[model samples]
Target: MSLTRKRKKELKRLRSGAEDLWTQQQEVLANANALAAEARKQAAYYTREEIAPRVRGGYDQYVRPAADTAKATAGRYVGQARERVVTDVIPAVGTAVGTALSVVDHARAARSAAFAGEFKKAGKELTKKTKAATQNSGPGAGSVIAIGLGIIAAVGLLYAVWQTFRADDELWVADEEPAAPASGTTQQ
Candidate 1:
């Protein structure tokens, strides 16, 4: 019904340990987020610098010559129009697509960073407010524990007093008739 001093001390130590573990978890989460952002940037850069050029080279080698042949088979005015689309429009579209992907990646990174900053700021503000409120509030943990202990002790004492003073006449049960006495024994 009551905690020993050692038990209470152990509980306090456990609470502090849990708080330390929580702090470590928060640090790990922040570090992981940073690493993810860096990885994203690296991937985007690799895509733009390495992969995009290779894709463009493939398109030029395989697709452009075919378009040129098709344009030659067509008449002069149609060929000129096809040449414009092949030379100008397709490359522009590819470049635009690459630029859009880059912009989207950058935007997502910026949004993530902004959200992280705001979340940290909110956490700091909340901690400050909680500390201030606790400083002004009544009945800290020790007081609460003491009150709980007092209630438990009161209940225990009341139970003991009740048991000590209460009658127990109805608690016993005897056989309806006594077993037959041994042959040499006399009945009272």
Candidate 2:
């Protein structure tokens, strides 16, 4: 079989048409992809560098002054607190430590003196004081005095209350003398 020239020409024309359609589609898709990439880059740049800075101004305009003032006040307070620790607290701690050291030193001295038999004068003075205390306050004198005072106060308070509420015309008393018993008594 031999091919005809008219059919070959027609086949060529159909192939050219298909290739044209494909080429047009390729151009459109390439342009769309390029435009999309450019759009993405522009959006990222706007958000990161341009629009982001403007939008972030809200904090600087509205909140920064108050935050700065608060920070400065807090700094001043920290300085004052440090000063107080250095001046007042440190001195108080030092005084307490000094007092403790002095107390220990005094106790050691007193113990050494007592052991060396050099505290005779002090011992005699202490003995006299202890003897005087024992004589004046025998056994539990403060407690006894306190108890006696409490009882007297209670009786005085009772008497005052009774006198305040009692009738003026009547008196409550007891006889000091008692009648002697009879030697022998008989009753029917």
Candidate 3:
């Protein structure tokens, strides 16, 4: 078969899109991790500057290796699917998700460790704020306000942590399988 002009154009676009998507995926993961570190810093958990290098190294070591494996696996799957075999993108997405999950676990552990190591007075600032809110409203409003604040803080932290691994879904997907052969084509 001969290559057509339109086919060549489509192939070029596909290749470009694939490259762009990979670069975009890396950028997204980096931003998410950076934001998570920033969240910890803004909360006075610790100096996030010190964490960036370690996080970058983790990406280089763990994520890069996992992603490389996933790419190879994905290419093999695509080869199989192109043979008219019914294959899915699960391997690609699964590898990416597994890597992200690993990172999430590490980040959570680091966060807890940081919180534990810091022996700074806890709840004193919160207590002051709670008291201030109570004065503005009523006497019994303090505990309720404190609980609400606690819930909000918990949710915010969860969100920040979640962001650290949210790029997995965007990283990889399975290719479409080849179409079935015609039934009337019985001759080999």
TM-score of each: 0.36, 0.43, 0.22
- Tell me the tens digit of each residue's lDDT in model 2 across 1-188: 86699999999999999999999999999999999999999999889998888877977987898899999999999999999888776665565455446556555665676788879754655565455446633434334545566799999999999989988854757567777878696887
lDDT of 3 at 108: 59
lDDT tens digits, residues 53-126, model 1?
99999999999999998787777878789998888766756654554465565556555655778766555555
Error of 3 at 161 (Å): 60
Off by over 4 Å in 1: 67-188
**Per-model C-alpha RMSD:** 42.4, 32.5, 36.2
Candidate 1 all-Cα RMSD: 42.4
Ten contiguous residues minimizing lDDT sum, candidate 2: 136-145
Q: Residue 8, candidate 3: how far off, in angstroms? A: 1.1
* Residue 75 C-alpha lDDT in model 2: 100
lDDT of candidate 3 over 110-170, digit per residue (tens): 5565587642333343444345445544423333444566799999999999998687866
Q: Model 1 residue 109 lDDT?
A: 56
lDDT for each candidate structure: 0.76, 0.75, 0.68
Top candidate when judged by lDDT against the true structure: 1
